[model samples]
Target: MGRRSSNKQQGGGGSEVAPVRLHIDPERPAPRKLEPAITALRRGHVIVYPTDTGYAFGCAISSPRGIAMLRRLKNMGERDPKPLTMLVGSLADIGRYGHMGNAAFRIVRRLLPGPYTMVVRATSEVPRGMKNKRQEVGVRVPDHPVCALLGELLGEPLLTASVTHFEDEQFELQEPEEILRRHARELSVVVDVGPLWPDPSTVLRFLDDEMEVLREGKGPVPD
Candidate 1:
């Protein structure tokens, strides 16, 4: 594991504006070596890391600044009002932030630790901004191990959103090198697990007894 932090002050205000880059094995990222990334999240910094689908932006769920920065990076409008997704380490972690009934839980249990984003009713613990008017939230448990360890160490779900190449809506970016070049000033840390294949997690919405497919991406919708 390699940790590189940029501490150059921005403008005359003496605010440091450099992003840290960490290259770790996607299979099993050592917890001790990931302390720097944890520290960045603790300080409300945005991180770019690989997932089962592709590279995505992440930050502490409790950080308003981090959330606002992510929205800005993605060019989300001031009143865009779209709910962001939550990334957790395991199936058990989902209940902490969202409400999953028996049907929903059983359905989620079959597909998680793979490429899928399931929408469930949000609990009060989830930040309001990350929930829609109906208080439903999108959650994911990526197949990648680094993010699982990250969520475990951080002790909470992370705010997650996909990253694109230079405002290109047609593609999702997977190259860490390109992310470093394009988003260095905007991010606090970039986790490099090499180039992942580009794809987006399939999105599903579960409202009470009803289940609906919101977006058809990488994962197959459960029949």
Candidate 2:
């Protein structure tokens, strides 16, 4: 068990926004205890939680409103928005949402649950707006207990984006207090697993017949 704190905006003309921060013990890694965060996400609220790369903000992939909240938090306007990544629970879930060829599947199955993001063609089940103009989406299965458990609790993939305040910065915010101080107003929940070492996941793209390395970060790319 851990402590919880929240912040809410008052006397506002807009929708009521209150972001709660909850702590999770890394050693325990309890999935059943994350019900509140799951409930918030089910209601189309975005959350900031720890991942293998660092802290990231995510929401239910099916919620357009949640996507909008995520976009607003990241300052991604509809006119030209950065493509959001999906955090899936397993490789099977990835297949359900993305069309993966045998070659792509082989590589993905071997390297997932690590620090990597794979870009693949999206399936019809994927929301239209969530994909790139090429009909592809970036997916990740982070190697962290909290996120893995959170994904299981939600029973679906989460639309994810790395947490970064400055564009030049390559890593996400690592401290829970700092994450709350900057983004708690816009977020719905922050699942803190203490402080994290800052880094970014390696991004790999599997297009038609080629495997291209998009960005080299914490994970090593296979030749």
* 16-62 per-residue lDDT for model 2 (tens digits): 65555576787677775677789888888778888888778888998
Clashing pairs in 1: none
Native-vs-model 2 lDDT?
0.77
TM-score for each predicted model, relative to the true structure? 0.89, 0.88
Candidate RMSDs in Å, in order, are: 2.9, 2.7
Give the per-residue lDDT digits (tens) of candidate 1, residues 74-166. 777545655678898878778887887788889889998899998888889898777866777889999888888998899878998888532
Off by over 4 Å in 1: 1-14, 165-169
Q: Give candidate 2's error at residue 82 in angstroms.
A: 4.5
Model 1, C-alpha of 186: deviation from truth (Å): 0.8
* Full-model lDDT for every candidate: 0.79, 0.77
